[model samples]
Target chain A: MTKEHIVSAFDRDLEGIQATVMKMGGLVEEALRGAIKALETGDTELAQKVRKSDRSVDELDLKVKHDAARILALRSPTASDLRLVLSVIEISAHLERCGDYAKNIAKRSIVLAENAQIEGTVPALRRMATFVLSMLSDALDAYIRKDASLAEAVIERDLEADDMYNTLFRSLLTHMMEDPRSIAAGMHLHFIAKNIERVGDHATGIAEQTIYVVTGALPEDDRPKKDGTSITFKPSDE
Target chain B: MTKEHIVSAFDRDLEGIQATVMKMGGLVEEALRGAIKALETGDTELAQKVRKSDRSVDELDLKVKHDAARILALRSPTASDLRLVLSVIEISAHLERCGDYAKNIAKRSIVLAENAQIEGTVPALRRMATFVLSMLSDALDAYIRKDASLAEAVIERDLEADDMYNTLFRSLLTHMMEDPRSIAAGMHLHFIAKNIERVGDHATGIAEQTIYVVTGALPEDDRPKKDGTSITFKPSDE
Candidate 1:
């Protein structure tokens, strides 16, 4: 084969790997959204669907990781190519973790669906999930396009999600205090917030991976502070 | 250098890295135990000590990871040796995460010490922390000794810790429901149990790393259950 042909083949492999990782990311985001929606709507069927879908994410995780490793072993590429392969592998792990967090939320959703009505909890969680999903999607975009600025934007967006979680946590804590009957439900709500918070964390991990791929440096964790103030909702704002 | 000398030199480096990882593991276990003790006893001073000691764990993590990566890049070892180095890197990440969880517990203890009495919540949390500490230490031992069976045991022990978390969570939820004033304190206690539960997860991650090092095969999550009932805990005879 010509040298140009060989290089093109390697590029194609990298593109294929990136595509799979993005697909996996999409599946994880969907799972998280489904799980949170199930909790919000008390839809056990949706929760069950989220749980079953996790297996596909796991399978994709293994496939992408194996394929990346196989490419590395065969091509023995160095520098940028090596970084690209490594980033794909790491991002796959992060996506798999996101899937696990979604599964955990689904498990808690099933329990919450059984006892109490989830009236006030789902909105906060959905907002947090939306922020995390965008971060993950943008990070993947930055990675594919090699856009460092876009990766930095994802890092910056993570603070907003953290703030949302803090607000959600305090509000849920107050809700549980007001209604004894909703204590179990509130705890479940708290866990869902936590899962969403971790989803943001995993998104930040993806951003770090992207930064590493671009600059060969790890990104620092720069989560915002909550300062212990309770978030009170305004009815007009909702 | 002669072949014998070269082999012996590599062996010494491997042994040194293993010893350092074990020492770091012990320090992490101590930090976990001290943090939980501080929480249980409401000792801010002890909590401060645990927080201070975590710096050393972080330093050890950096050193071990660097050494392992250096060995991998410089020595270019194959097969089992390569797996050992990779496992050390992953295991160090898990250990560092465990230390972070310990630090989080210590930080919470300081806050809990200020306002609320956590006497009822601490014992169960301590039990779970102890279980995680043992699993972490045992997993390190299994790694150093190449005992797959022991690593498997550590994996099995994680379920017990998970059960402890669920029980503690339910009890704390009940406490918050019984008295609205206890909500903040209960939340702090809930976070403590969660930190220990996370420590157990890190221990399981370490066990999986150890297994990968020994056999180059990753273990399944293997959480036992039957007929929709999670077999994570048996009713405590206490």
Candidate 2:
């Protein structure tokens, strides 16, 4: 093949893999939103739908990984091209995990539907999910636009998600302590909140991949993380 | 360079990456063991030490990834050789996350040390950790020896971990419900159990990579997953 033709083919291959990643990202976002909506409305049907859709997300992720590896073997892409392929693999993996978290949330929503709503937990969780959803969208946009600053912004926004989660954690604890009967429901809500928090982390991971692809190095390891639930032994009321 | 010399160098490069992965796996296992010991004994110092040691694991993971990328770019390995390199990258990533879960357990252990013990949670968590540690070691051994059957066995063993986690989940909830004062400690123990359960999942992921490296395709997605916590609203008490 002519040199120009070969280079063009390689570019097309990279674009194809990236486009699939975007499609996968869209499915994940849909799944996240659908899961939260189901949680809010106690819609078991919607939750089941979200759970079923995750298989498509997983399939797309595998396709992206396989395509990127093929390009790595065939094109022998170097420098930024190589980084792009590696970053795509990492990004797709992160997106797939996010999809799994969404599925977990859906599963919990299905169960939580039968139980009495834990006071205000669902609305607070919805807000947190909304924030994390924005971060996922911005992270995907940063990858597509090659905008490092936007990716960095997504990383910084994770602090906000953490803060929201902590607030929810304290409130859920208070609700459970007041009524032991809500213990199971509160625990499920806590996991749902935790799942949303992890989605934010995965979004930040996607942002990091973008920064890596652009600058050829990951940002400093000391990214801001305000998650304190692991160390929190006392509810704020105490 | 002679063709034979180049081939030999590629083999050396692959070996170097694999050795680093084993080293990373060792560090992860140590961290898991230390974290459980700290939890069982309420040894805050050991917990702190386990948390500190995770940075080394992270650094080794970065080195392995960089070495794999360098080999891919320079050697342009294809077919099985390329799969080996990709698998190393994935295996290292899984090991790194397992390290993170261990660190989380350590962090929680530090907090739990100050609280009254939550009945039998610590011993149960330790048993679960031990089981997960074995799975991790076997997964690493499988990777080194290219034993797909051993890796498959590790994959099957995750169901037992999930079953153990479910038992812990119910017992912890019962304790919290019986005595509202233990809610904080119960939550912390629940998270610790969850962390160990995730370690098993990561080990299974490593095994899947080994399988992919050996067989060129991932196993079916319908592996045994008995983690019913997300779907269990009654806590086995109702």
Candidate 3:
């Protein structure tokens, strides 16, 4: 093949790989939204759908890795192209993790659906899930556009998700404290909340990879973390 | 430079990256051991030490990624060498996550140290941590030796860790249900248990990478997972 033809072929390979990543990201976003919707509406079937969708997400992740590896081996593209390939692999990994968290949420939602609804918990969780969903969607958009600024914005919003989680965690604790009878349901809701919080984390991870792809370096400072539930606890005696 | 010299330099680069990964893994193992030890002994200072050690692990992870990217760009390694580089990147990422989980355990240890020790909790956690620590150590060993069988063994052991986690989960829930006053502490302990379980997951991840590096293909069957907490919840009234 002519030199130009070979270069174009490599570009095509990268484009194909990236396209698959975007498709995978889309599936993850759908899973997150569907899982939360199922939790909010008590739709076990929808939750099952979200859980089943994860298989496609996992398969796409594998495909992206395989195709990226093939490109790196055959094309030997250097500089920006090399960064793109590496970033694609990392991004795909993050998306796969997000899919897993979404699946976890869906699984818990199915269980929560069977139990009596924990009063006022689903609304707060829904809001957090909505915000996280936007962050993930924006992060994926930034990846396609190579917009570092947009990715930075997504990173900044993770703190908000953490803050929401903190509030939900405290409220859930109080709920269980007030009525020890709700402890089982409370634990399930707490895990679902934690799962949503983790989905936000993976979204921030994707945004970081986007910044690395565009700027060739990760953000210098660690993103703000407001998860204080690990350290803060009200003694029952108090 | 002679082509032979170039190849030798690439070999050195691969060796250096692998060595750094092993060092990072060693730090993670130390952090895990120290965190669990702190929890078991109620040593806040040891917990602090484990938390501080994570920065070094993170730095080593970045170094491995940077060095691997450089090798990819400069050496243009193909086939097995290329796979080795990719595997190093993945292995380093897994070890970095393990470091994070250990740090999380340490953070929780500090908190738990300040609070009253829940009876009979520390021993169970310690046993689980020890098993997980061995899995991580063995996974790293498999990586350095390219021992697929050993890696497969580590992967198999993850199911056992999940089973241990399930047992711990039920026991903790029972503890909390009996005394609502212990809810906060129970939640923290549950998270610590989850964190250790996640460490095992990452170890399995590293082992999977080892299998890929050795055999040029990932195992077709999914590793077994027995984490039933999300799906199984006994009603509080029961």
Candidate 4:
């Protein structure tokens, strides 16, 4: 191959790898939405479908890794090119993790569906899932467009999800406190809530990668993570 | 600069990055042990210490990425050499995640100590924490030596930690059910337990990277993941 042909071929390889990552990202967003919808509606079959489809997500993860590795070795792209290759690898992994969290949510849906529905819990969780899915989709768009502001915007919204989780966790606690019957369902719902919270985290992670890729700098570390605060409480003397 | 000098410089760069990864791994192990000790003894001071030290972990993560990217750009390593660099990048990220989990466990310890301790729970968690730390240390050792069998051994031990988590979850549930008083503490302990469980997962992730680096193949997928199984229970009618 001529020198010109080789350069064009490298560009094509990078583009192809990125396109695969986008496809994987789209699938992951769908899985998150589908999982939450299934849980909200007690659609066990849709939950099962979400769980089963993760195989393709896993396969895409491997492909992204493999192709990125090949590009790194063969093309020896530098600067922004190198950053894009590395970001593709990192972003692909984050997308895969989102896929896993979605699968976790879907798996928990089966159990939640069988048990008594915890009041107000499903709707809160459904909202959190939708919010994070939007963040993820936006993060993917920011990555594709190399829009750092959009990526930072996604990061800024993470604390909102955390606040929602803390509220939901306490409400579930009060529900269980009022009625002993809700404990089993409460525990499952709590985990599902936690799973959705993690989906937000992974979305933020994708945005972080995007910021790093665009500016070649670390994302801001200003957000004070108020994570374990939700678990703190006044010791009720029984 | 001669090609030979450039090649030797790449070798030195790889060595430096690997050494940094080892340092990060050691710190992560210490953080895990310290976090668990803090929980075991209700030492809020030590918990704060573990959380404070994670900044260094994050810095090392960035440093590893920087050095690895430089090697990829400047040297263009081949075959096993490329795999080793990629593995170092992945393993460093896994170690950073392990550090994050340790920090999370420590953060939750403050709440657990302030509130009433669920009877017999801290000791169980301490044991699980110790078990996972040993696995992490062993996994790191295996990575340094490229010992596939030892790495696979670490992977095999993950289910042990999972079983421990399942048993502890049930016990915590039983405790909460028997007395409304234990609910707050039980919930905090449950999250701490889950964080420790995730530490095990990250350690296994490092081991999987070790296996990949040594064998140039995916780790065996024979072990069935029994996760999300702990949430399944027959709800007792109140």
Candidate 5:
């Protein structure tokens, strides 16, 4: 092949890898939705399905990373290409972790199904999941369009995720205190809330990587401040 | 300058960046120890000290990333050299987050001190901190030596950290159930344990990066899995 042809071939390879990442991300988003649906409806079968799908998520993540490494070694891409490969790898990792967070929620849903009911907290958890799902969807959209503002918007939602989590944390504590029988269920619910909160974090991570890929510079000064909400479970009624 | 001289200068730049990473790692290690000590002793002043120190860690991380990017752009490092630069950036990010985890522990320590006492979980949290600190130290050494075995060892320790966190988790639940007054303290302690657990996770992440840096191929098959322990909380006596 001519030198120009080889360079074009390298671009094709980078494009192929990016397509794989989007596919992987789509699967992950599906799993997150399925996990949440499983939880809301208490469907063990759907929860089991979500758990099983994580293996493919893991496989896809490995393929993306390995393919990116191959490009680095074979193409020896220049600065911009190198950044693209690196961002793809980082974003894939984030997506895989998001998959794991979903699987974690599914596992908790199974546990919660067998325990005493704490139905009050379910709406809050669902809202948290819905909000995070939108953040993730938008994050992926931002990546494709190279939209820094959209990415920034995705990151800003993380603050809302945190606030929602803090509210859930206190409400769960109150429920547990009111009925000791619900403590086990409460703990599992708290963990599910935490898992969803972390999904928001990983999504923000994707947004950050997208920012770096688009802009040569990191967001230095105006990085959004994380909510310093206390996780301490003090009931207001106390 | 001769071509050979230019290559040698590039090597020196890479070496300097590696040293900077180690310095940042050391500072993070110190911050973790300080955070743990402050938490264990309920020393709010020491906790304040750890929180203040995180700024230096953040600054170091930013400097490392910027320097690495310059090397990528200006020096145009070879494939292997590029991998080294990228690994340094990823590892530094991990270390900076490790520092944040410590800072978070410090922040929570301040809140815990003002809450009612829950003395039983302290020693367990201390042991968990000590274990994760050793894991991080070893992982950094593994990176310096390019020893995959050492990295694998560090990765394996994360299992133990997870087990320890689970134990601490169960005990905390028991305490919360036994004494409602301890709920607030128990919640804070649980958060501390979680922060420490994430430190172990970040250490494993560094070790994984080290393996990739040494071997052209990413470790595909023998990847250390997070322990799939049950998240269901149950009282020991029950």
Candidate 6:
């Protein structure tokens, strides 16, 4: 085959991979929202949906890898084409883990919702989850569009999720301290914040991978600053 | 260069990268143990040591990547050799993150040990840390030796650490419930358990990478059971 033919073939494979990943990302995003809603509204049906949908994410993960490998074996791509395949595989793996974290949150939400008193800090948990989901969506978009700048923005936004998680944990701890009866619910909330923080971290990982795929260089850690309302990403070089 | 010379050069480069990663792993293990000791005995000096030594691990990470890239550019390896280099680069990244987690734990230990009365959970944390360190060590060994079975064993052992973390979190929660005054300390301990759990997850990631490098397949979820004791690895037919 001519180089042009190979390039086109690889591009088609990558497009397929990206489409599958975006589909998976959409499912994970829904799962995260459903998990939080399950917690907020005590919707066991939503939690069950999140649980059942997790298998689809996992199956998509395997399919992406299988298809990527077939492309590699048949085409024997080189250089950037090869890196793109590897990055897709790694990115899909990270996204699958994000789904797993969301599923964990859904399971915990079910438990927390079952409790009678509702003793935990709910608003902080919701805020953190929202920030995490936003980051995930932005990061995936940046990857699909090869938008290094947008990926950098997603990386910057991760700090907001982290800060919110920290605040949520502190609030939960305080609640448990004031009323020992809040321990079970408060601990569940802590796990939820932790899962959200991890989702944000996975989003950052995706952003980093996007940067690598686009520029072949890892971006330096550009810590975002908190201004009470939202965290702003300021690149270190800037 | 002849194919034989190129192969030898790649082998030497792989060995060099493997050596640096193992050194970094050892340093991280020491840092994890030091952090636990600092928390258990309130040793700020030890925590300081861990925090300071982390820079060396970061430096090693950069050095490995540079060496791997240089080898790739010079030799232009194909197929399995290419996969090996890519896996090394990715594994090094994971190892760097593990080092970061250990440093974070040590930093938190300094503040937590200052006022927290930690009595019953220190041993569990230490034990879990030790288990993770061993798993990491074995995973590295499996990579160097190209031993898929050994890598599988390391991956299976992660369940033990997970169980320990869940139990530790529950016990700490109960303690916080019993004595509201211990809330801050208890939360700190909970974070420590979390760090250890993350360390185990990183180890598992490394093990999976090792297996992938050897067998060219990703392991299924295979999370450890909840008993904190034994685990089995069942390879998927796909």
lDDT of 2 at B60: 96
Superposed Cα deviation of residue B168, candidate 5 (Å)? 1.3
* Winning model by TM-score: 2
TM-score of predicted structure 6: 0.84
Q: How well does candidate 4 score on lDDT at residue A43?
A: 94
lDDT of each: 0.75, 0.89, 0.86, 0.84, 0.81, 0.74
Per-residue alpha-carbon lDDT of candidate 5 for residues B1-238, written as tens digits (9 for 90 to 100):
6555555778889989999999999999999999888877889899889988988999998888778767766766656776788789889989988988888888888777778768668789889999999999999999999999999899888988988988888888888888877776676788788889889989998998888888855556444344332344322211
lDDT of candidate 3 over B36-65, digit per residue (tens): 988888888898789889889989988998
- Candidate 4 displacement at residue A56 in angstroms: 1.0
Candidate 6 residue pairs in backbone clash: B159-B224
- Candidate 5 stretches greater than 4 Å from native: A1-7, A221-227, A231-238, B1-7, B75-80, B220-238
**Compared with the true structure, what per-residue lDDT tens digits does model 5 show for residues A30-118?**
99999988888889899989988998998998898778767776776767777788789889988988998888888778777777779
Per-residue alpha-carbon lDDT of candidate 3 for residues A120-159, written as tens digits (9 for 90 to 100):
9999999999999999999999989999999999999999
After superposition on all CA atoms, how large is the RMSD of candidate 5? 4.5
lDDT, model 4, position A83: 91
lDDT of 4 at A119: 76
Q: Taking the tens digit of each residue's C-alpha lDDT, what string does model 2 give over A1-238?
A: 6555555788989989999999999999999999999999989899989999989998998898789779988999888999999999999999999999999888888888888888888889988999999999999999999999999999999989988998899899999999999998999899889999999999999999999999989887787543578756633411
Across A1-238, the per-residue lDDT of candidate 1 in tens digits comes to 6555555778989989999998998899899889888877878789889988988998898788667656755665666676777678778988988998888787777776667664667877877888888888888888878888898888888778877887877787778777777776776677678778878777877887788788976654334422122112222211
Query: Can you give the lDDT of residue B73 in candidate 2?
Result: 84
lDDT of 6 by residue, A132-196 (tens): 88889999999988999999899888777867776676667667777788776776677677778
DockQ order of candidates, best first? 2, 3, 4, 1, 5, 6
Top of the candidates by DockQ: 2
List, for all models, the DockQ compared with the true complex: 0.31, 0.61, 0.56, 0.45, 0.30, 0.28
Considering lDDT, which of the candidate structures 5 and 6 is the better prediction for this target?
Answer: 5
For candidate 1, what is the recovered fraction of reference interface contacts?
A: 0.21
**Model 2 clash tally?**
0
Shift in Å, residue B115, candidate 3: 2.1
Better of 1 and 2 by TM-score: 2
Going through the candidates in order, state the TM-score of chain A alone for each one. Answer: 0.87, 0.94, 0.93, 0.92, 0.91, 0.87
